[model samples]
Target: MERKQIRALGRRVKKIFIEHDEVKRIWSRFDGMRTYIKLDQFEDEDEEENDDDDKRNLFLTGLSGVGKSQIGKRYAKSVPRYTEIIDDEEIDIIPVIYVELPYPFTQAEFYKEILKALGTENFKKEPTVNELRNRVFHLLTKQRVEMIIFDEMNFIMRTKNFDNQSAMEMLKKLSNQLQLCIVCMGTPQIEKLHTMEDEYVRRFGRDRIERFEKCDEKFCELLERIEKAIESPNPIGLHDQSTGLPQLLHYYCQGRIGYLHLILKESFRLLNVYEENVQVEYSEIRLTVDIIKQAKFNLFRKNDHLITPDNVDKKEYMV
Candidate 1:
């Protein structure tokens, strides 16, 4: 296939989203947060924030590329920011702020991430952390931002000896000071925060998007869904027990959905329906195990141990 055609097909493959159990759980959590925020009726006559039942925030942890970031982005997109006329000025009503915590993160960077998500960060000249923090709070309140998703929160935990404790405290502070829902996504290391005796630790719900533990019936069910989405010319019977493909794929992907997605997308690019390879009854081209076997090498550039000959041979037993 030509490079142009291959890329188009690859993009289509990349766009597929199977609402598996994990994904469904994420969506439910996100929607629950959204609904709670809408129904939040806690109030205080005096100058105080009431969080008696404001545990709508979420801390989603998982392995890298395990779909946390994707779900975060999708949820943020669902409640898109928009401009509205209030009084006499155009106001930016950003319901959700989605920003990735920059690596080598600092307290200043933390504030800037939120500012950047709000589309109000001054890039030409850097501002003091104090200034940025004030601006973040002000803008979040002014724009009616309800939820703030801090993706790649692994950096926030490390802080690299740079006011690490204070930085984390900032997350808690944001929730209390602004009564905002704080959603964070990152590696499982971020879950360490739960062990601390923070004032608001219990107010944050925790969930993890884990990889498949086995190539059992559940994994085969996912394969069946992916096959349907791939819209391949002919059904590959990936879920068929006779194929022994589920086990092989579970091994290849280390049960990681990310690697499985990468392999399937690359396979789409490799398939040649009209130009080369086998054509079924002069009608349709079919995906084969051979193509997937070749696609495994496309990742890691031959660096991953999972793709090494020894590992592959051992994992073959699962097939």
Candidate 2:
């Protein structure tokens, strides 16, 4: 790719960071979670009752490519890191700490991950699980972290040595002991963690991130926003008069924002290669769909139910 082509591709890729309705919703939820954390933190310490039993934990689940991780990162960045006055001393408070769970994780590995996220240089050098856990708790409390977000939480289920019950216990213990909010983001498979036990289900509230439905008004609005975000020298009619762009995209990408991103990135790359002044047309989009179909053969094969308009039912796609 030449300099201009590379620049054009870079511009298109940068547009992926645009905050849509989904991103806004995630932010709203994060704000609410922070409010709850504040309330719990300031509760009467002398009260005989244990109000901390009420879980302020959030479980954010969605299918792959629905922007779960992206929204989590955005929320993390929005939190202001500052110092708080406590007992005549200034203590550093990290409003949010985001960590991604490693695959085949164990309880020890999980705490090690938290220690690593806290910027501990020799975290792996901890001799025992007790030491690791103590270090994690000490760092989180000392730093005064309001919320801890665990991304790719579904890895708990895939771990060969760890069972779902043990993972749930660990999470529950952390939230109860730390007195801070915990947000877990992962694929829909993580929903099984909630279903494994009633205590788990009661403690963690669920938040779902869904893809764009074909016939929904928001889908059309999203398309318009996406069109405006794309910068082109020549005017581009993204949608065809016969079949709307939303419908076409739904059929090709199965309403996945990640797949749509791939299609658009490839489309822009194609325009950079052939057209002098980059402008996207309905024909170019159609060609891009064919190219994506060939490139993502396995994806198309798996989601064959979304391949045609006839297969898409009114109940599922309707607003």
Candidate 3:
């Protein structure tokens, strides 16, 4: 196949992005958070110093590839990208500031990461912890950031020199000082934060992204969405008699959206390779399964949980 043909197929596959009920629910929660922040800002001029008003922070927990980051990015993009005026001066209001937490980050390192995410030129420069903290506070306020989202928050737990107590303290302090809504996205490990401290628990609301289980109506609906997205000459029906691929895919992917996406992308790639047409069929899906399995095995090795029966919930697929 020509490189251009392959690239075109890739583009078609990428267009298969689907937003389901879960995404809407997450986005709604973010909307509520924004409302709370706006109310806090309006009612109190000294809201930044008032620790009495509980922080309307959000914690998004899920396994990898359950679309937490996707939902976060979508919600962030929905916020108007513009500036605000304060005291006759123009202030750039970044409605959302999204930062991915680096593994094993200290309070200082975390601030530096935020600076880098904010496009600071000398983010790597050796600044004192206080200096960094001050800079972050100034930038966030000056930029008029309404919310700060930290994705991959589980890295805080995975860090070798991590101190949960001090970290929690810093986060609480920052929330009170900035008075900006904070959103944390990570795997199930972040649930540990809720148990670490009462203040921390009180500050954030938690939501989990569940996997698409086998035999569920949502699973079939997701397949239908996928079928519609694929621009194939032949109708691609994963739920229909020609394929009945939804069940097989649910089993093979262990209900992971990421895995399903990989399978579909590979299926499209295979179609491009041999058929020279965008025709997704049962044979293409079946052929792509092995490719997905092998890729998963090569990347994750023994930890390829998709192939492990234990990863699947028996109650959900027992029938």
Candidate 4:
């Protein structure tokens, strides 16, 4: 086929299959359940434990590009839903405080960011860090901020020395003092923070108590749904009647929900040129699969090594 014809096909396929909004909605709802709701509920219950007078804290650890930050944002968005269940006296609306911990390794710096997030800027009284910390606590306590989400908490560890450790201790102390469930979201390296010392491990509790990874079945199902949402019926080429649709999609995605979308999106871009339905067989998809797998491998190879302080500055580690 001519280059112009191929481009035309790519454009047409994109138009036929692309429901960007619907795809996002589907992914969001599923992500909310599989990732956010589970964690948010933990925090919600922790808040309730304090006679509904205090917020809750939770810590979420996962692999990079494994949907931690995405789910964190969704959890924050869903904070309003908890308001309906909350009594007016207990909390007017569940205030979700989401702070990306890309900086601020010390208690002072951390508190400064907390204050900034709370919209308390420039205390003319020249308050010390302790004072600002107390102010944030009081504000959250009074405001009924039901949830606090710390995304990219791995950044805290990059500050070097024991700063990250000390900061985490302060966080744990605040969680106990305020009876708030604080959700810490970050890459798998975050487990290192807890595993470093016997005391540290004890303070953070057991691994099963905090970190949760998605099951393979759930991941594949998520990818299949995304494929259905973004795929159009093919018309011209050989449509292998012998094979299964879901099976084909699952194979293409290789169990990574994120890569599934990326491949489908790129494939559509390549097929937009012609509006005619072209049958996409397993053979046609082999090239796409190879491309996606190579990309994935290259990405993992670059960062799969131990997350050193230096490597943490790369794109994957940043918020």
Scored by TM-score, the top model is 1
Error of 4 at 256 (Å): 3.9
The TM-score values for the models, in the order shown, are 0.82, 0.78, 0.80, 0.53
Against the true structure, candidate 2 reaches a TM-score of 0.78
Of 2 and 3, which scores higher on TM-score? Answer: 3
How displaced is residue 126 in candidate 3, in Å? Answer: 3.2
Which portions of model 4 show Cα errors greater than 4 Å? 1-59, 81-92, 116-128, 196-220, 228-254, 259-319
Measured over all alpha carbons after superposition, the RMSD of each candidate to the real structure, in angstroms, is 4.6, 5.2, 4.6, 10.8
Model 4 Cα lDDT, one tens digit per residue, 127-215: 78778788888877766665567777887877775466677787777666765556677767787776765654443432111111222
Question: Which pairs of residues collide in model 3?
Answer: none
| Number of the predicted model whose lDDT against the real structure is largest | 1
Model 1 Cα displacement at 22 (Å)? 2.0
C-alpha lDDT (0 to 100) for residue 181 of candidate 2: 87
Instruction: Give the TM-score comparing model 3 with the true structure, all chains together.
Output: 0.80
Which residue pairs collide in model 1, if any?
none
Q: Residues 83-161, candidate 1, lDDT per residue (tens digit)?
A: 9988998999989878899878887877887888888766677788888888888989899988888888777666667
41-72 per-residue lDDT for model 2 (tens digits): 56688776444355478899887777777788
Scored against the true structure, residue 143 in model 1 reaches a CA lDDT of 98
Where does model 1 exceed 4 Å of error? 1-7, 42-53, 122-124, 272-286, 300-317
User: In lDDT terms, how accurate is model 4?
Assistant: 0.50
